[model samples]
Target: MKHPSVIIFFLLSYVCCFAQEHTNKEVDSLYKEDQFYAGITYNLLGKIPEDVSQSGFSLGFHLGFIKDMPINKNRNVAIGLGLGFSANSYNQNLLINKDDLGNTTYTVIEDTGTYTKNKFSSHLIELPIEFRWRTSTATDYNFWRIYTGFKLGYVLTHRTKYIGDLGKIRYSNIEDFNNFQYGLTLSAGYNTWNLFLYYALNPIFSSDARLNGSEIDMNAVKIGLIFYIL
Candidate 1:
């Protein structure tokens, strides 16, 4: 599903719920404060970019999900709290920094490098509850849906191991999350299904081996489909 589609669904759901609220006064009055939703969501994890630019994506993969949420749908907004599990990895051998003190000297070493292959696998339990503002109750005129929210995730395991070329490779010792992860997400979509993209603004690792702050910067862009089975 695309980013825009997610927003459209949110808007459509919001409008439908609101309209129903007025006609079904008894149901609305007796309505439970929340709704329970569980479904499978597939995600594409792009290559961890080296620079601040999010434009380049050389490779990506799929992730699985299991979500359980208590939702509240109202006129202006609705909130969804979900728990999901995903497995994703990316590899690049050519960009491994090799000069030891390479960045400090500003000089290129003479064939003094090796292309290292490694993968970072994550086991994340995510809780993302988003709030959306609907412009209208009618889907025909409601072509816009805007959302902003936060997601809290705990890292169960983070592993980075080297592969290929037996004698020439050395492995890295990864640091675990200090405790938990807290980040923000923004998206827009339309049409009752999922037409939206999600952006994560958080570092994947809680600690870096370099001791500089974040050992690696993890910014992700995921576009997918979202709908309900039940």
Candidate 2:
């Protein structure tokens, strides 16, 4: 769900029901200096034109390491910094193109069996920074947590593929693809299964990219399950 109410509801419920129980000493022991995170998310295009729509399921994966730095004596709150890899695929009816003049464009086309397996995928090297909070003791493996952060990603690879018609065709590392991306992220869970959300602040294509003479700007939104090991 795109609505923020869903996120607020869970967070508020968790805090109200459990946050008051932790003692100062117990909270102090909650933070771990190092953590590993993994996530599997469903991807969506947040602002695509009504005429253009997703055709198939889009899946995304993220794996990262974070080093936590306690900011208070209680250690229930901390800041995290880390590096990782991210990759995602989108199967949609929109197709990427270049006009005769070399201007990049996104065109909505019919799938009539002329082409199959149409999709676009990208991989990135990323740095994540987070502010974390939790209710836990040193020995507690299960805890309530709210982690919010931003991640900056540099494009590592990009590909577009189509199989059918004239034959299999693929484009790799298209010049019009955005090389840099940054997004806001949030994760909250009682234990290993966290609800994760990522909203990209940048568009998928360069500023100059257009469709039918209109600028084409599409940002990504992801929501799903995330796990953590500390």
Candidate 3:
């Protein structure tokens, strides 16, 4: 599979989760630690035509491990770095097409009965760096945390799926997608129920992508829940 990296990444996380178990005192004394994080997010296009707006739930997910380096004596403040995999899907009315001249275009598909489950998905391998704050002491299992970070991602795969008058159809390895993506992220909550936020800084598609002679500069935003395990 093209995404063997994702499987390998998760297997590493599963191993790390079991390899480390620390008492309260040990946790407090440790200058550095690592954690596994997983999250599910709702995704939406930041910019899109009104006629081509999202038609259904757009979901995304991420999983990975982060090495935390304590920056303060209290161990409540730290910096983190990690590698992860992320996948995002957007369900919308827009259809991707290539013109006779061989240029990619986004067109609004207005016939609802003619098309169902029009969605595009992309998978990425990402590196994340974050500033972390927590109220946990060595013994505390339930604590407040706020983590804000930046992520750089390289696309591994891109595909589109739809059910239409022609029948169920799928296309993979879209060529016009941007291969590199960078974004900002934030997660804040108490204990295990963290609210996650992600905003893409660059367009999902390359500048060559066009709709009606205008550039299609759509970006993605995600919001949802994140869970961290140590």
Give me the candidate number with maximum TM-score. Answer: 3
Best by lDDT: 3
lDDT of 1 at 171: 28
State the lDDT of candidate 1 residue by residue for 42-117, as single tens digits.
3333433333222122222222232323233434455555565433343433222224753211111122133234
Query: Candidate 3 on 78-123: residue-level lDDT in tens?
Result: 9999998888889988887556896556788888778877888998
Cα deviation in Å at residue 65, candidate 3? 0.6
Q: Assess every candidate by TM-score.
A: 0.49, 0.82, 0.85
lDDT per prediction? 0.41, 0.77, 0.80
Candidate 3: count of backbone clashes, pairs at least 3 residues apart or interchain:
0
Q: How well does candidate 3 score on lDDT at residue 161?
A: 82
Give the C-alpha miss distance for residue 172 in model 2, angstroms. 0.8
When summed lDDT is taken over every stretch of 10 residues in candidate 3, the lowest stretch is: 19-28
Where model 2 places Cα greater than 4 Å from the true spot, the runs are: 1-34, 98-105
Give me candidate 3's TM-score against the actual structure.
0.85
Give the Cα error of residue 192 in candidate 2, in Å.
Answer: 0.9
Q: Cα lDDT for residue 90, model 3?
A: 92
